[model samples]
Target: MSDETMRWAPAVPAANHPGGALRRWASGWWSVVHLVLHPLALALHVTALVLLVTGTALVPVLGIGFLLLVPARLLVAAGAHLERYRLAAVLGVHVPASGPCPVTGAWWRQLVLDPRPWRRAGHLALVSTFGVIGAGVVLALAGTGLAALAAPAVSAGLGHAGEYSWPFGIPGTLHAPALLVAAAGVLLLALTPPVARAFTAVEVLTARALLGPGRGEREAVLRRRVETLTETRSRTVDSVEAERRRIERDLHDGPQQRLVSLAMQLGMAKRALDRGGPDAAREFLDAASSSASAAISDMRHVARGIHPPVLTDRGLDAAVSALAAASPVPVDVEVLLPAGGRPSPTAEAIAYFCVSEALTNTAKHARASRAVVQLWHEAAPGAGLLRLRVSDDGVGGAAPAGGSVADGGSGLRGLGDRLAAVDGWLHLDSPPGGPTVLEAAVPWTVGGDR
Candidate 1:
């Protein structure tokens, strides 16, 4: 589909208006229960942080302080992780995990330089305070409501009307104080959900802001993407140029020469006919016919090299099946695409080429007796991806650019570049002397008719 037609629109949540007493009461009770646990969880978080900080300080003096620090930071991170899940569960707000931690450099250097750890620590500290306050407020509201609800029972048991007072000097009543207190209790209970929601929102927002991917990590991701794109762009340009040269060479050596010969034979036949030599003209015409057929066959082969007609006509499934059928060795093909679900033309073409190239490499170099090609669509929230896996039981010492395959040219690397053009990637797993698996994934969304 066109980008304009597939523009994204934000989804707004429908507001809940309590339509029944039962719903209000249940919501209030749920708030009271969760609010009671919120404080406990926060208290635990605070205690863990305190211990973590203290342990780090003491261990540093003992020369093992750095070792303790790493685990301490991890503990802090673990607590923050749990809090993120808790926020999602209790508050219905999802906070995704922070991006991967940098593990390449010295552990101490990475930990010290990375800001996420410190941000998580800060969140732990603040959540403790927020949790305490929320717990206190919820408990006070629930406790007061419960106390008011029990006033009538207490008064009846004592055989005398109990005195009850409302907030802000609303005045206590000895006569029918039970009714007044119960009414107050019901009011308090009704207000608890909104009040608890307000308090919980603070913690949820804090976790989302502090416990998720920070600005630094996001920028780092973008920078890496830029580098990848630059490399892929260069490779794509080189690949296109190499392909053009290849096609030129094919035409020069194959179809173009054949057509030239065919024209020469036709000229010779015309001359023989002019000389009234029927037998010589007939021989020349026969040769010319053979040359023309060879030329047509050579042109068809070149065209197939550019793009297989089957791929355009029948989609990825049929294209891949044709590839498997043509392989020198046995190939097992499995294609799992949903009915009525088709990837964009570009995606399908890329997938077909990747499989074709990989299978060619397998058949030519792997010396394997058999191979397998699997294709499937993976669906996600906003988009889908086409996943292809080609594996062969061949002598597995293949690298993208070097090794034995170096003589075979940079076909694998070119495939990677092709996939990268579509925001896809290629992964190669070829160990010393065993199976070699090539997997590629490309983003694809259902588009307008083929």
Candidate 2:
């Protein structure tokens, strides 16, 4: 699995193991004695697990009981609070203190009102039950060790009383069985932390599910999203302005000045027409008119290329229609939109030009039979969500650098930069051998202050 998949995998605690060779040897033999003690430890774990699961699962049932014991609700509430804290420590969960569950009139009524209180209550009750089991196991292990110390004396005919040689009337002459039991008890105590941590993890998960944050937190998240989108909008405007300046410079120096010189020559030719004969004047006039017309046409095309009038007046669907008609290849378009859901003018312009550029690339390079264009107002799961996309189908392996922007000589790099300025993104997916798709998404509301 990929890293993302692994990141969301569930937690599993590791089992405790001996740290060194002496400990390992002790543990190997300890296991033999532990067999005598395993049942008790196992019983503790099983009992605790069952209680924890049952109490949490039957929260609803206990909620009903709270209604009848309204007076003792404090005690019940206290017990739940302790369990929550203890569970946090045992399970090693780092959860915020939610404080006590509020007191409601009639314990049973309160329990019925909220399932969580009872669920937590149930878990606490189970923890208490498991606490008993764990204590019993410890006691059993201790008892076995104490009895083993006395066994030697009892076997020697001194009786159990004669074995009392140390503090608390306990014997310290370690025998095989007694030593083994003591070692096993130490191991069990050491393993408790891991067992507790597992339970704590479960509690953390349960609390997260049951006591999720309120509406205010959700609104705060939404606000952050808006803030991020606003920042994107500002960047988009800056990028667009930069692009405009670049295009203006390109035209002013290259086409615009050339057109101006062409107009001057045409004017001179017109003056010469007055002095020359009718035939010569006619040819000069024709050439002058041709040059003037060519320059005028070039300027007009440039102005239209800068920002198409169709896009401003007709919106994305209509503008894309105009582009489709102009494309060299047959293009099919499908658009579904609300009647009044017009994208902001800038977004519409960007989208129209983007589709225009993409389709132009497809027609010029992708050796495909047909192309499809789709436009729509799509909303994601949250509020304030609106987006548009354009896609195409043609020969695969088309990329901005390889075909569209590079070979076609359009500043598509500027187009991508413009989209980015608005917090929008452009995606191109094409693999060699036959179908290429391009997509772009931008916010509906204007991104920047422009």
> Which predicted model would earn the best TM-score?
1
TM-score, candidate 2, is 0.45
Write down the lDDT of every candidate, Cα atoms only: 0.77, 0.57
Model 1 TM-score on a 0 to 1 scale: 0.66
> Which structure among the candidates has the greatest lDDT?
1
Q: Please provide, for model 1 over 1-450, each residue's C-alpha lDDT reduced to its tens digit, 9 standing for 90 to 100.
A: 654344444333434544565565455455555557766676557766775677556654764666666776877878887888776566556787789865568876665556677778888887777766777887788788988898777756775455544457665665667677789998886777778877766766777789988877778989999998898889889888888998999999999999999999999999999997888799999999999999999999899888889877777888898889999989999999987667888788788888888899898888898999999988643467889999999997776422332223477767777777668878887776858888888887533334
lDDT of 2: 0.57
Model 2, span 146-252: residue lDDT tens: 55545455544654432334446655543553455556655665554334334334545655443433244456667977987686577557666876887798688
